[model samples]
Target: MKLYTEDPERILIYGGSRKDSGEIRGIISGDTLKGSFYYSSYGGGTLKRYPVAMLKRENKWLLGKGVISIYMGIPSYLKTEPIDYSDPKFIFEEVKK
Candidate 1:
């Protein structure tokens, strides 16, 4: 298991502090949305890369939880498995280009 310092309450996507900021790069596989997100600190700073996984339910992309770590100096994205739509704090929408 990889160790991470991310608190779900501090994620920006959930109206929390700017604790997470990263490039929206993901692929929709079946009902699973696999993507790569990064976390920041104190509103702004060096962005650390991590993984992100969301579940598509009823045409809505909901957020999930995953691990955070750095191995071999590679940007590891967040890996989320399971859909928790019980009371989601953040729902990923279509990124306007």
Candidate 2:
């Protein structure tokens, strides 16, 4: 994933595979960013939407609690949970050049 700062307060985040990709638009304030994410799934079979917030702490980014909705498929569901920042699966680090 990559995150770009469009301005002082606006951020653009994007990443994914060849068949699935996602983008997020966020507003930054201090060390926190609040945003929404839209995802396109493989074969264009599913779409996902979610509210996301990230907090920069030291060298890592932590994902905040939010609700996600999965659509465009049968038996879609909504999930609400808090992201565990200490978990590698939920934490993000900056990409070094």
Write candidate 2's Cα lDDT for 1-56 as tens digits: 54433333222334454443466666899987767666565535666666677888
Q: lDDT of each structure?
A: 0.56, 0.56
What's model 2's TM-score?
0.51
Candidate with top TM-score is 2
Candidate 1 structure quality by residue, lDDT tens digits, 15-53: 432344435557888998776665565447787666666
Instruction: For model 2, give the 10-residue run with minimal summed lDDT.
Output: 4-13
* lDDT of model 2 at position 26: 68
Clashing pairs in 2: none
For candidate 2, give the lDDT of residue 21: 45
Clashes of 1: 5
